[model samples]
Each structure stands twice: as structure tokens, then as C-alpha cells.
Target: MTYFVTLEGETYEEARESFSWDVPDGFNAAVDLVRKHDDGDRVALHQAFPDGRRERYSFDDLDRRSSAVANALESLGLAFGDRVAVVVPQKPANVLTHLACWKLGAVSLPLSVLFGTDALRYRLTDSEARIAVVDVSQWETIREVAPDCPDLEAVLVVDGEPEIEGGTVGDASVSRFETAIDWRDDDHEVAETDVDTPAIVMYTSGSTGKPKGVLHTHGVWLGHCPAFSMYFERDLEGTYWTPADWAWIGALGDLVFPAWHYGQPVVGFPMGSFDPETAFELLAEFDVTGSFLPPTAIRMLMDVDDPADRYELSLRAICSGGEPLTPEILEWAEAELEGTVVNELYGQTEANLLVTNCREWFPAKAGSMGKPVPGHEVAVLDPETGERVGAGEVGEIAVRRDDDPVVFAEYWNDPEKTAAATLERGDGDGQRTGVRSESDGMPEGQAWHLTGDLAERDAEGYLWFKSRDDDLIITSGYRVGPREVEEAILEHPSVAQVGVVGVADDRRGKIIKAVVQPAAGTAGSEELREEIRELVRDRLADYEYPRAIEFREELPQTTTGKIRRSELE
Candidate 1:
């Protein structure tokens, strides 16, 4: 049976064999994937704004705009390996800038528009980015901090007139992006880039301190399209929508690049905000076949009074990532959205979509992350010994890098941190017996990337997510998973959202604190907090119950919808 799940078709695997991963040597994604595969006539990007404005870009148009941006960068004397920081909201100009960087073989650093001036400076300095392409609205923030960044040479403003300010030292140049694109030539050649060459440097959300720049190569990203296409069972002919920002790997690889590679039309809602009603309208309007939304968005959509009445979902499959999809959200989507199966994919910026539950493989266990993708090996290992854990046992989620083609190379400019993250145990006697190791270990070539996530594997080889290693809340020698506590709190109808964190306590060493966003119009009170604590105690272990509850309007979340537990803590 073909493994394809269609509105009308065979199983997905049978249909998937037609499309395979066969990246050519010195392949630049802009030239090889987007331009060559999509060609000139196919619509590549359809961007809709909340203000009723819409723009469409064909593959040829994307190619031309990107080339223009590349030529403009070259005119500024930026070359291969030079870092270019892009600080724009989810918009067409952001997409153009990213592709343009790929054309010039420059490393693109995509920064979150929500970040303040200090956060921007940290990334710029850390990557040593030479130029920054920023939206005009954010120009003041960048301008305020640009003086402190000695390495920054140019600031190109998108959608704003350039006004040079006084005391701007060095050869710092300012130009309107529209004027800069005039230097673009239709036939500008794409520079040759090695497969292992760094294409993007994505910064992790720095909850602890400064964010680390995770470097991904052309080879890594090139493999992403094939893997995602296979997992989602996306046809090269269908439309795909991933409601995320360009700053995130989920949006960049899973939505934009992969869809482009498959010669599929991609849709972007670039109003720089997410509303369930608007999202539902777009899905109906575009007749999107495949789509992705965070679990939170799914919940919001579920809360809509009459989703079926409001939207016509031609969507064959929908997936959620960035955070685990709750069972409540899953059931809601199935019932309200024409019985569409909501598959969950588990991955991070460090590694994109490592394990994904296929739409055809529905009824997946709640909180399970599914099996590892083909060509990738996933294991649950004892955090200290690095020994593979037995079935139904929770351990650190580790990926064998030797066979995983999608694994990232290193953290840019931070070799020590990279070594720590990518290095694992080797097959050696005594201390290393039956242990998984890094490339520096196993006979000079094998390595494994340590996924900081903690998970468990059942007897059937289904992987179940537990919590991030750092996210595990320990109180009085009890190992409590925040997700379990959060899940229990979510059982309450009044609890719209919650984040559990361990707070330092004098008596218990640490205590569980649940920061909750109550359902709209629900009043917060001491009685409610006590009620929630008792409810958790009934559902979970005694230690897992949150001792205190703090009410908030909404829980802090990353752009991709993962709750910012660190921020809550």
C-alpha cells in the first residue's frame, strides 16, 4: 500500500518514492531548489495582510528580487561568509533578504522583530554580522544601539527613507532597500557554496543568558525539504501554510524553503500577528491542502464559536510543533475542522523536525513525538552514563549524528559549546561499554548530537516526550516534570494556559509554581489556586502538584508557540 494520505489517493510511502533526496554538488538552494525546481511561472509566495492588502510573488519574481538584493549587498562590498543580520517582521522583504544572502553565499542571521535593542546588539556582535537589513519601524532601536557595534558597517532600511544621523562613525552606510535593489542584475551568478558551507546562523531564545547562534549548513537545510515532504506527505503540487515567523527554523525550513523546493506554492500571512478567525478565513480562501499551527493556535481556533461554519478547510493534513499538542487540542481539531488529523512533529532550531507523526499514522499516543525519520537514529539515554535507556524509561533524547544528514554542524563562533552539544560517548571498554559517543570518539569518525530534550520510548518504539532537561523541576528530591503538572492544570476548563517552574525555597529546596493564564472572563482567586493544586494532586504524584499559582493574562511564548518557562520562572 502506498503510504500517501490524500483527500483521494493511495498510501503515503507509495506516492513518496516519486520524490527523493538527491542534492547535487555545490548546490545553492536559491538557484538549485527555488529557481530550478519552481521555474518562472509558478506562484511561489502569496502574502496577505490584515488591512486587506495582498501581494503575490512568482518563483521568477523571488529569484529576481533575491538576485537584486544580492547585487546590492555586493555593491556594499559584502562577500561570501560575511554575516548579514535580517531584523524584519514576517513580510516579503524578509524572505527576499534571506534568499539574497543565499545567492551571495553570505551567512543569514534571522533575528526576531520582538527583540529589543540590547538583544539585537548581542546577536550582531556574537555573529560579527557586517550588515543589517531592518524594517523602518525598528530603525530607531537599531540606530540607538548601532553606535556600540563597531563591526556593523551598513544599515539598510526596508520601507523607509534613509536619513543619515550625526556622529555615525566608520564607513557605516545607510540606504533605502528599494534604491539598493536597483543594482540587481537579472543574470547575476549564484556563487558556488560547498555542501558543508554555513547558510544560516539561527539564534536560540536566550532564557538563560545570551542566545547561542546555531550554525546550519546548506547540506543540512537541503535535506530538510525532502524529510519534511516525506513526513507530511506533501505533494509537489499542493499548497502549504506554516503560520510562523522567518526568525524560526520551523517557518524558514518547514514552511518556506521546503515548499519552494517541492515546487509548491507557499502562503504567508504577514500581518505580523496571528488571529484564529483571520487564519481560518485564509485557509478557506486559499484552499490550503497542508498546514501547520502551534498547539496554542489550535486551542484558540477550537475556542471559536463555530469553526466549521466560519471556514471551509480543504486541508487534507494539519501538523503542530514548537510545543507538544495536547489531547484536548487534538480532539477539538478533529471534531471542529472536518475531522482533519493533527499530526505532531518534534524538533528544534538545533535540528529541524527529527521525529514526526505522519497524518496517516493517526491516533498517536498523547504526548508521544513519534518515530525518528528515516536516515536518522533517535535514542533515550541515561543522562549521566549515556547508556540507552530501556523501554518505558525516560532519558535524555539523543540523536546519532553519524547517519543523520539533517544534523547541524556546530554553534557558530562557539567551538567549545558546539563540542559539548554535538559530542557523545563512544564504544569503548569499562566506562564507555555499550555507550554512544561523538565523532571525536568512535574510531575517528562517528558522532552523536545530544538533544537536550528528555523523552521515553515504549516497547513499540514510540517515543514519548517528558520535558527538557533544564525544564525538569526538582523539589525535595522528587523529580517532577513540568509538562505533567501543566497537563493536569489544563484539565481544568478555567485554565486556558499554564507554565510550571521550580522556585527556590528555603524549606523544600525548591517548590512548584504554576503561572497560569485563566480562561477569558474567569476570575482568579485563592480558592481557584487551592482548587487547582488539589486537582493536580488528585491527578499526579504529590510532589508534582504546583504549590502556588500565579495568574497572568497570558503565558509568555516564543514566536513558534513554546511556552517560555524560563521567563515564567
Candidate 2:
């Protein structure tokens, strides 16, 4: 039952027979998958620092270190299911802490290291985290905010001295992670937890309002790895790199879990800054076989003047997600990179990759999101009527949840929000409704997780993406999706990258405003704006073209490579 398909041009299949998981009552990802399945000598992680320092950890090293961390947490009397907030940059300690939590069956809440005292306090307070693992650099900031987070019991510093400040419970209780694991005779057994129990609380990218914690179970997360391996046909012995934070599910799904399950070594470069050349060098030096990045990073590499000569990319497969893959970028990768296939997948934090286009399926339809992965059913339905849409017609993209085990359990502590996303009826339409009735053996709303993204299913069963439902701009009585306009503008040779958003317009309600980052040495002017508008006019409908274009040096992007559209709007 393993699914196989060509992405870009190469064909691959999953090692697992099926995507289904019979969760064995109580499941622990770290123990069952990492400890039990992994060979002790296999390199689990290789971390390189910006200062030219490097550290490697084998599965045995990870197991022992994580066991010590588990013991330390237990010694502090923090039991299973207690929340532990971690605010550290990408590093070995960060990864180890997560593995430690998984071993203890404690929920790991990874926070962005960029957060100041105010932002950090919010997540700590919201999750009611009892322990905080923070970077030494941010220790002062954490100290400032720790008093406000009454639930915070201890602070584990990663790269500096553990000084116990006064006025905190039990003298600030800090532990330094620079030392090797002092494994004691204490047999730190992995906790037995229900498969449905919360394993990780991943916060949404927060493009709209406050970030919501999307709760996922062990079964759901583990189910994703096999699907990923099947999709990529990843070599079990090859090296993989995903320049994504573990906080994001994309990293967890595509990099961590699969690599661990198959015993492949993974490289994690965790600096706060991104250097395209350095990234390229890393790929070349490591002989990375498979790598995944956001389209933004790919575009950045493409924008480099001498990419082919500068870096020797021995990559077998190059995967991009977090946003739509532009045809221009795809074309560039094919031309410049030797025999590398670009794989694009469509997924969200709520679910791992539901649909993907492989490298063997190269020369794919320019705008299509490809076919649904086997074992899942995908449909395009009218948002209001819930009727399945005809080919090429835009509607909400809904995936059938009947047999899909990778779907999230629920939103953490937000039953009302969960109900809104999962329980709503499909307008009582027989054809469009994924749920038959409450008694039909399907949960009322859980029958389908309404992916707020809008798209169209082509005659070939391939899904063509449109835009997010909230991102549709209504201007001058005309509705427009920013993606269409951005795609149109991107056709202009002078435009390096463009972000389209709805700016306030009294006459038009909300006119299309495009922020463009021009090609090198290109000047921004009214003429350039008009030229972009004309290009859009040629490709898109008259109403969908950008009326106003603002030039920018760069555009903001998320860790997953999606444009921060909320930042622009």
C-alpha cells in the first residue's frame, strides 16, 4: 500500500507498506521510534555553529543525553504532561531538550529565540509552562520575565554559567547544558502515554491574530514520517538538511521524524541569520543528498550571480514548501542545479503534507499543487454551499478525514475554536458533505478539517491553489487573490520578488498593493510600476492586476519560506 509517484522526474516509494498506524494503545515517539528502531552507532544529528565549531551526536548519544535530561526534569518533580517552554536558537541542546520531553511524555512548547521579555512571557503564561530552557544570551531577558511567569519553576541555560539569582524559588534553579551527560544509575524509563495524548503544541505562524497552539498526538506525528519517506523516496543512509526550526511542524515532519525513523543523519544550522552562500557551502561540504527549504531561500540562491560555480550541490532532491513554488524559480533550479528535482508540497501546521508533487513529476502544471498523497481524499468545495466544485472552479480545498490518521487531535484548550474548524456542517449537501450524520460513525465536524486555503481541482485530479480565504482582496466590487497578482507581477524580468497585499482604498474598498524587490541594479520608479502593471494586465484579468506598486529592498518571510502577508497588510 506504499504510495509511489514521480516528482519532477524521479520515482520513489515509501518503505512502510501503508500510512495507517495502529498506535499500540500507549506510544512514545522517542522510545519506540528513536531508541528501539535506531542503531546505536548511526549518526542522528550533526550541528555546525557559525564560529566554525561543530558537534555530532549519534542515536546512542541522543538517547543517553535525553535520558539524563529526563532524569533532571523528573528530579525537579515535573511529571509527564507538564509543559516545558524552550526559547533557544537552533542548536544541539535545543534538539536534545525536545527529545528529552518526548521521552518524559511532557509537552514541548518551542518558542522563537527572537522573542523579547514581553513575547516570551505571553507564551509561558499561556502554556503555563513549569520549566524554561533558554539560551544564555537571553538569560537576562528571561530573568526579567520569569517573575511574571509564576508557573516557571526552573531555567536551563544552554551556553553560559548557571547563576542562581535571588528571589526565585529554590535559588533560580539553573542548569548548564555545556557539560556532557552525567548519566546516573537511575533507570529513566520512558513514560507510557496514550497515542491520543498531546505530544507537541506547535503554535501557528500567526499571520492573522494571536498564535494558537495546534495540538498533535503521537500517532498523528509519527504517521507523517512514513508518508514523507514515501513521497521523497529518501535514502535511508543519505544525509538530509531542512533549514527550518523544530518549532514548525514542517521541520518535525520532513526532517526530524523521518530521519530518526530511517536512521539517516541530519544537519541543523541554527544561526539567527541566513546566508545563502553558507547554506550552499554546507550542502556541498556535507554532500547533502536531500534538502528542503522555503521558496524564498531558493529564490535567494537563484538570485546569486554565480550559483553554479560558487557551490557544488550534490543534492539528489530539493524540496520547497511554506508557500507556492514560482515557475521561474523552478525553471532556474532545473537549469542551474545539475539533475536536481524540485519537489513542492502543500501542507499546514494542523496537518503534515497532505498533497505533494514529486521530482519525477517535473514539468508539472505551473500552478498546480499536485495530487493528494494516497490514503487521503481531496476535494474542492464551495465555501458557502459545500458543493463540490467543477474542474477549474475556485473553492475551499477539503480533505476527507475518514481514514486519514495524520490529522490533528484538537486545538489545545480551545474547544470552541476546534468545533468551529471541525464540527460545522457542509451546508447539508449530500455531495459536498464529508460528514454523513452524527450517527454515521463520523464525528460531526471532525469528518473534514476545513483547510481555509482555496483552490481548484483540475480534470486530472491535480489541485490548483488559489489563495487563502482571508487573503482574497475585494477592490472596486471585484475580488482578487494576491497570489494571482503576485504571480503576474513576477513575470516582469526586473522584478526579483513581489508581495501583493490589500491596502486601504476609499474608492476601491481595498486596492491591490504590490511590494516589489527588483532585480539587482534595477531602479524603482513609476515607469517600473507601470511596466509591472502592464505585465500583469497581459497575463491576468484586468481587475486582478496591481494598481499600486511599492518597491522594497526585501520582503519578510516565515521560517517555512512563506511570505509574511500579515506583515505587509
Candidate 3:
């Protein structure tokens, strides 16, 4: 009765029938990612620089450095469950900090380097980490935020030399990465942790206006394996990379852990910001064979026509999430990227990698999120009753929480919010699946975590993303999902990025409006605007087409690179 796929599957049904979860009593993130995999000189990562330099780090290098940093942090009074804020780009130091924190049984909170001073201060103050590992560029600013983060006691600066006698800055101790760990022995043992022991806390992109910390356990690694395998396929080769920021679960769970679990080297190429040309360069230069490209990245990559003719690329598999993978882009990837297949993934920080499409196992539907991956039950149900809706009807996606290892431990410290994610629904033929929260939970509810997304399941079992509950537009009597309209407009060559939202209207309750960022050298004009409007009208319903179109050089995006639809107004 099991439908679990072992990391490699010849057929979807065959794989699921043989799949299972095996989280052991004694589990450690460090041991799983670095300890057992390291054969001393096996390269673990390749850190690429903007200056065209690349440095390789072996498993032995990480093992030695992480153990030393673990001991150093422990000496500074960091204990089990203590949070360590790791603020850096995709670099060796960032990986080392995470491994070290896990080795000491501490929670690693990864914040993006793209975050400004205010965003950095907010996360530091909120997570209340006892220590922080930051880049040298942020050493001076860390002191400015230290007063606001009273719980933070130590700051380890990467790529900088310690300046002070005792390495003290304000109320917190500050020392360089090497200086802090140089005095400690590099042979410390990893902490013995349970499958349920908390490991990492990642903040959501806050597309809803406020960010919340999502805490996950050690079992998450086991939970991510099957889908990762499904998306990347068997016998992973060459280097794995993702343009997604390393702080997000898209990179950490989908690429880093899964790639490292197979002992494949990951490219930590932080280009400061995502550039389509630079991304192509890194993939070619490093011979990257597999990657998880975000939807935006793939869309931008489409701008380069005849890419197969332009550069030499080793990419064979590319899995994308964080946005819908429009058919236009998928077609472009398949046609121009040589052998790359773009499999779409669907999940949030709360529940990573729940659904995926596997190469050769099945044919991908245009813009479909694919079926639920092996090891998960997925259903589209009514938001209020949790009853299964008939095929072709939209419903909130929900995941069964009882014994679900991939579900996060809790919303960091917010019990009400954590409890809010789960609900008691009538268990009338309930299936495991993957939405937004309902205000009132029925008293006699079965445990199900809502994903806050709206989607429809076809008779064939493929699910298509409609829009976030908050982003759904109601104009007159017709209902519209912004994504449906956005995808239509994106098919037009001139459009690069767009955010669709419903604005208040006098005649209709709200009218659809699209704020678009055109392609480079393309101007937003009346003729172009009409073409975008006509494109949507021809593709989707007239109600879904934007009544108004505004042009801009850029759109507001969350730190994680998701468009902020709430800000479109």
C-alpha cells in the first residue's frame, strides 16, 4: 500500500511501490550532508567569484573548518537550540557556518546578502540569534544592528581580519572567520539529534506583507530526497547550481542538500543579482549539468534567442519553482537549451518539494504543476469543508500533517500561527495533498496543513496553479487568477516581467490592472499595450484580461525575488 519512490525510479508506479521514509532515531544534518559523504579529498563545492576566479573546497576542508567553528561557537556559550544568523551570499563561508551550526545542534537562520540594512536589522532582531556569521562588507553594519539585537553576542566576519584587541564591538564580540576558529581543535564530534530535532529556520518571502520564520527538523532532508531525485533524475552528474538565493528553501532543500546527499559538487556562484547572461556563463564555464532555475530566471533566459547556438552548456536537467512555469518558457528551454528539461516543482518553506514532474516517467502538461510526487497524497478540496471537489474545480491545496516529515516543526515561536496552519476537516475520503489559512477551524478537524494556493486538478491528476488566494481577482461576477493573466501577457515577446492585481473600481467591485516591465530596449507604448491586452483576450477570458496596463522600469520584488503583488497598487 506504499507509493514511495526510492531516489531512482524506472517507472512512476514502480518507484512509488518501492519507496519509503527512513529517518533514524540518531540523525544529524552535518553527518548526513558532510560526515558520511566526505572521502577526505572529494570536492564538495566550487565558489565562483565575480572577478572570474573559482575556488574549490573539499569535504575534508568543510569537515575540518566546520568542526573548528563548532567548537569555537560552543566556547562562546552557544548551546543546543541556540539560533545562529548566517548572513552571506552563496559562498564557502555560508556553507561552513551552516554545517558548523548543525554540528553543534544549533539552528542556522540564513538571510540574503541582498537585504538592505533595515531588512537585516529586522531579521537579526526577530530571530534573537546568540551569534551571527556575516561577510566582511557587513562587519561595520552588524555593529549598528547589534544594539537592536541584544541576544546576539558574537559576530564572525568572513574575509576580514580582526581589528580590535579582544575582538569586541559594542555589546557583541566581533572576530574574523579564521581568527574565531583558529584557536579551536578541528576534530569535534557532531551532536546526536533526533529525526524531529529542529535544524533550520528560514523566513518566508512575505508576499503577504509580513514575514514569519519557518522552523524545520532534521527529517526534512529525508523528506526532500524523493522529489529532488524526481526533478534532477538518477545518477546526478557534473555540478548542480541554482540562481535562487541560497537563503530560500528552493536552493537549500531542492539543490544543496539533495545534490550533496549524492556527493555531487554544488556551484556557489553568487552574482550579487541574477543576470540571464551571467547565469548562462556560469552554467557553461563550470559544466553545470543540473539546476533549479526560478521561474523569473527562465523567463529572462528566453530573451537570448538561439542560446544553443550561442554558448556551450552542460545542463541536462532544470527544475523550476517559486512561480508558474509558463509553456512559452518551457518550450523555449526545450528548443534552445539543447538537452535540458524544465520540471516544475510546487511547495513552500513550510513544506518543501511535495510535488514534482519526472523526466521520461510522464509527459508534462502546459503550465501544469504536475502530479504529487511519490510519498505524498494530493487533493483539491473546498477551503471551508475540506471535502474533495469534483475534477476541474479550484480548491485550496492541503497536506496531511499526521506523521508527515516534510511539514515544518512550527512557525518559529508563534504557536497560534503554527496551529493556524493545521485544521480539523471531516475525513471523508481525504487524500494527502497540498493553501491560504481559513480563519475558523472546524472543531472536529483532521490534521491538514493548508498551502495558501488555489489550484484545479484535472481528471488526469495534474494540478495547475491559479493564483494565491489573496491575489485572486473578482471583477463584476467573473473570477480571475493573476497568474493566468500574467502568463498570457508573458507570451508576448516584448514583456519581461509583470504583476497583475485588482484595483478598486466604481462600476465593478475591482478591475484587473497589470504593471509590466518590458524587455530591454523595448518601450511601453499604446501599440504595445494593446498587443498585450489583445494577447490575453485571445488566450484567456476577457474578464481575466487587464482593464488597464501600466509600464515601469522595474517591479517591486521580495528579497527572495518574488514579485510583490500587494505593492502593485
Candidates' lDDT values, in order? Answer: 0.75, 0.71, 0.81
Model 2 is weakest, by summed lDDT over 10 consecutive residues, at 1-10
Q: TM-score rank, highest first?
A: 3, 1, 2
TM-score of model 1 vs. true structure? 0.91
Write the residue-wise lDDT of candidate 1 on 1-569 in tens digits: 01121222254344433433444567775775467852477888888877888888898888887888888888888899899999887678898888888889998999878778788888888898899998887878887778778889988888876555322424467777777677447557888886677888998876544578988877665556544654565454678887777787877777677677667788877656678878888888888888777777777777788777767778777767756577887787678777777777888778777777665533467677776655466677777666678898888887777634477878878887776675445544323223344332234344668878888888876787878888887799988878778888888888888888999999898999999999988988898998898899899878888887899998887655678787887
Off by over 4 Å in 3: 1-5, 38-40, 161-169, 425-446
What are the TM-scores, per candidate, against the unseen true structure? 0.91, 0.89, 0.93
Top candidate by lDDT: 3
Worst 10 residues of 1 by lDDT: 1-10
Show model 1 residue runs off by greater than 4 Å.
1-22, 162-171, 234-236, 424-445
Query: Could you list the CA RMSD of all candidates, in the order they appear?
Result: 4.1, 4.1, 3.9
- Model 3, 82-104: lDDT tens digits are 99998888888888888888888
